[model samples]
Target: MQRWKINLSVLWLGCFLVSAGMTMITPFLSLYLQEDLGVEGEHNIALWAGLIFASNFITSFFFQPLWGKLSDRYGRKMMLLRSGFGMSIVMVLMGFAAAPWQLLLLRMLNGVISGYIPAAVSLVSASTPKERMGFALGTVQSGSIAGTILGPLLGGLMADHFGYRPIFYITGGLLFLASTLSWIMVKEKFDKKAAALSAKTSMLGNLKKLMRIPQLPALFSVTFLIQFAMLSPMALIPLFVARLHGTSEDLAFWSGFVSAATGLSNMIAAPLLGKLSDRIGSFRILVICLLGAGIMFVPQAFASSVPELLVYRFLLGCFIGGLTPTVNSLIRRYTPDSSVSQAFGFNSSSLALGNMIGPITGGALSGLIGIEGIFIVSAASLLLTSLWTYRSLRRAGMGAEGRTG
Candidate 1:
């Protein structure tokens, strides 16, 4: 096999393991706080869970660009190994935490070291041929989506059969295994001396230079809005399911189904759309998918039953699948080869920012506008972004084929 193909295969597995490890503990975190860590009271456990969960993304939002910068000077595979090994150790220690504070601190540390996904993305993007960029990213994204969909299900079963602490050990072990495999199999032809020269400018200097490129800021906004629109309603989804179902019995099952429905379709759609992007154009597909996703959200706001919501969510996923990969491809198209890792790093930070803020904003807005209203706000945001993106690209004279500059 060719070197890029081998790297993609190994990195795909690495991305999957890390994505699964990040999400797996979520389903049982509250229980871990109450049972394993001996936290008392419903409010206290809920508060701790929210804090511990959000803390990771909060730190991640601030730190991703720094890692991205360093990765440009160093090598993407090195950054990938650092994050994989660091997160593996942190996750293992969480199993030994005697108190909630210890676990919270560890989660923050995990976030600070969390660059494996972005680094894998940078490695793949930089190495893959431009013509195949979309498909390669799409394939890698499918691995991530698959991991996300299955992680909670597996975690729940393991928590029931074994125990919470053991699940942590298992997750940590799996991360280490993925890292080890990546180290052995993934190959990067990184010219460290040249990369160091390209990255000689200070981080802020690079940020200003990249932002001055007209296409990047718009692309970055699309990244933030896509994540914001998708995640804002995630936490309140079960409540929405209950409201639509009109009963609490089997509510958890129905809610899980509705949530996974999107991912199931997304896992299927990403690669297909990515392949299509190679033949046509990524920007065109991005606009159409954004419009489609926005329209899907509208019907979801008016969904009268859980089944109706499920259908809308699944359709939305098909379009959401097209968003991220294309954005990465477009970023690569606009970035210099020497600085592509740093560009992707800033994009990752944008994604992290959306992840951190979306739920908080969603929770706050739910009280003022209601859950349905949040859906409407999300729909409106995407639709507006779609229109803005189209006009922005056209005015910049970037044709459907994209400018290689």
Candidate 2:
């Protein structure tokens, strides 16, 4: 690999580690809250869990754009190091939590200081040539998916043998290692003249500037719909599987299998779709990915057995796998180099908002309409978003053939 690629790969590793560190304990967290923390009450587990996850995103959402701006003003490598350090500390703190509320507080802290993906994204985008950009980012993103795929399995196994604190302790150490990696590697250019723009421009002006790009709405809308649909499959999978006679042994096995299936497919497809976007255009890939996601997720609601559910989940993973790279490609294609980080910061916010709503919506719908029906809502939303995306972009004459910027 080229030196720049190697640098990004290092940063990419950090991104994955951080992602894994945060998500690794998710499977057993509810149990820990209810059993260990003595968090027994009406809505306490649900409320605490919501706050725990939501805290991270709330911090992330407010800080995301700010981090992007800081990165633009300072540098990506430094932010990478900073985020790793912050995340490590928070993860360690999480291991010592005495209550579910403590965990929620720490999760908030995690999000506020953590912006690994955004920072790593800035590094990759700034460093890579336009021709190699898509593949590079797809690869970086795949690391994150890989983390998600491996996290639960590792968490489960480790939790049985080592317990939750040990898992967090190890993840904390890995996060510290990731911080070191960024500090030692990952280099990028600093433009002297352009550094003054963000300070000169107000926040509203900056946001307005980002929004003016004609494709921004299209990209943002698709992001929301996909994220909304995507959360259901993830949040409810364990519960859904349990309802279908899944066992403890089966939990890790199925979680690992399904998570691996999605990650494996994303690992295979992300770079391929990214490379395709370079040749065929982002929206073309976007439409197909979205439509396929809608179709695939529908089957999950209909799944009756573990094997059947995994198969549908695998298919859903395949399609959802391709979506992020497509989003990154679209953002890269339209946004200027000067403002890419800021644009992505806002992009991060959109995802955070989606992240905010997705689980709650999915959880609520599943509870109200029944578990299988959630996929119906997911499918209909995805299809509508896909059709909307295609129509809007086509009417504006946006397609795969026009990109070279």
Q: By lDDT, who's the top model here?
A: 1
lDDT of 2 at 122: 69
lDDT of each: 0.82, 0.73
What are the TM-scores, per candidate, against the unseen true structure? 0.77, 0.83
lDDT of 2 at 106: 90
Per-residue CA lDDT of model 2 for 40-157, tens digit only, reads: 7423454455456556777787877677678778777777878889889889988899987788789888888888877787688878989988888878876777787777767767
The digit string of per-residue lDDT tens for model 1 on 1-405 reads 878888889888888888888877755676677678997764455456656766789998888768867888889999999999999999899889999899889988999999898789889998899999988987887678778877765675677677789888999999999999989988888998898677256767778989988889888888998888887776566567767889645544566567677878887898899998887889888999999999999998889998989999999999998999899998998899977867987887788888877766776677678778889989998999899989887675556464322
Model 1 scores what on Cα lDDT?
Answer: 0.82
- Where model 2 places Cα greater than 4 Å from the true spot, the runs are 1-9, 38-51, 124-142, 184-199, 275-281, 334-341, 399-405
